[model samples]
Target: MVYIDKEKLKEIYPPNFRLDGDIQKGYINEDGTIEGVFTLDGFEPCTLDGMEGLWNEEKRLFIPNEVAEQGAKSLVGAPILAPTPKIENIREFFEKRYSMLDCYFENDESVYNLSTDEDVLKKYEDSKTSFVFLSIDMVKSTELSLKLPLELNSIFDNLFLNEIASIIRGMGGYVYKSVGDELIAFFEPANLLNKVDDSILCSDYIRVFILDYLNKFLEKNNLPQVGFRTSINYGEVYVKNVGDKLELNGYNLSATIKLQNFAKDNEIILGSNVVNIANKKWKSRMKKLKVNPRKLKKEGLHEGMKVYRLHNLEGRYD
Candidate 1:
């Protein structure tokens, strides 16, 4: 059974009283009394005193199936007088919950299941396409980590990671993994080749966005500035569905790592493929902004070698 994030549920019932037990175990009866066996901290069926204080007609409760499976209570109650939760907030809650559980949250479980099947693999063997991989690493992460106090460091990490993930999602990219001070993302060639021009445009916009966002956040918090070196690569990568998880295998991964290593201080480097689509005009713009752009030599790149650079900015990327 799936579990909803408790924090998200709290947001939905902002001002209402929440029963403290696992919500899935309880359910509401037709008459409005909680009927199941679930434990409720502030509710007492014997007295019905708490019931009097609860909103009657507009009340709603969220119950997970696990609680019900445990033979817990049924009629957990919550007033619905609060505003409806935003879709984005709901998405974030689920994402955070799954991340905390160290589980992959499939947007479409059915698709994942079907794609991973042996029969499906035989049918779509040749039809499967590859993806481009990109990694963004925080520069001097150890130094930056040391500069911030423990409490502040935790706050900064949470804020920065979420911001970066949101940006990638907004740009139609998938975040493969988010490690200590870095995140890896992927772009499917099938989705990108159609609008190659748009993809290039989006990439540049996102890089600038990250730089600006970090700068502003640091300035506002009066924290030491932090910068990032990003490496992006394109190649034929095998994307496979493993149960509920998606995995990528190919040179793109290694290429992105190599590009990251090649990135100079406050500079962005582009692979031949990326430069072909982006053109020298974009490089000139970076120069005018005092951002240097370098081309990686063939010897410096590998089979999946792509583009990379360090972000230098005066303010945060909005």
Candidate 2:
């Protein structure tokens, strides 16, 4: 949430400045002459930069813009909503779900089962391609979906997906799939090292963008805030087209999802393979995460294998 100094704004809004300080109207713009300064408590006063008409749907009120999110809402100052399922609960949650997630790890060759539709059968070719996979799971989305009307839920989901996809593409990654409450993307192997770095970097951008920017924007509007977890892994996968969409199957992809499941809200988990290939700066930020050996092997990961998390984030998983 943010506030403006009504007295000060009244001084600025007049014949010199035509618009008022109403954020709901989304009308306010000025160089140095006339401006409505927004202050997020405990942070320095700042302004949202852009032409007028901020309420325009394109402005995306919640999250507003990069300038709006970062300007007044500092990453450290943004109100982080830590709902139910604390760190200990996250550990217990994954431990209990091992049985449910076994299918992803049961087979060494993680090939996608061909779709039954006859028309797209030929598109399911045997060719395999290497990709650095990134998975981001929105936390508590199911609860929000159940509570919100269907159309409203979709609006929120699309808001998230569209913003997230922009971040991924900005880092030169391709969005492979977006399932309910989960976003899966791929970076090509043509430039493996850089792609791995790109995949790892996505988490950082997303962390601040969601927690500091989007969530704050939503909170200001009196809407529910959301959180997410991300995982990155690198490997080869069989790629096929099913109804104009790319479907991928690979052991590493499953491993990515498994790692994401274990991550806490606002957390980024890295598979050992991703760490091995990631640049030194990114690797330096990670603290090894321990997991049950039996469950690790069941997820196509081996005993004594390493999983990593950004050590700076608050969590007991390390």
Q: Give per-residue CA lDDT, model 2, range 1-318, as digits (tens).
A: 332343544453332221211122122333212133332222332334643222323222322333343332211221211111122332343333322222322432232221222232234465786777888878899999998888777667766765676567656676766788788877766545556766776667667667766676677657799988899887777867667555677787888888886688778888877765565566669889768888787776767767888756433323
In model 2, the clashing pairs are none
Q: State in Å the error of residue 174, model 2.
A: 0.4
> How large an RMSD does model 1 have?
20.4
TM-score of 2: 0.57
Q: Number of the top candidate by TM-score?
A: 2
| Cα misplacement distance, residue 124 of candidate 1 (Å) | 8.3
Tens-place lDDT digits, model 1, residues 3-109: 33456555654332233333334455555555444433333222123222212222334234333222222212422111111223534543443343211122322
Per-candidate local distance difference test: 0.46, 0.59
lDDT, residue 235, candidate 1? 56
Residue 303 accuracy (lDDT) in model 2: 76
Q: lDDT, candidate 1, residue 23?
A: 32
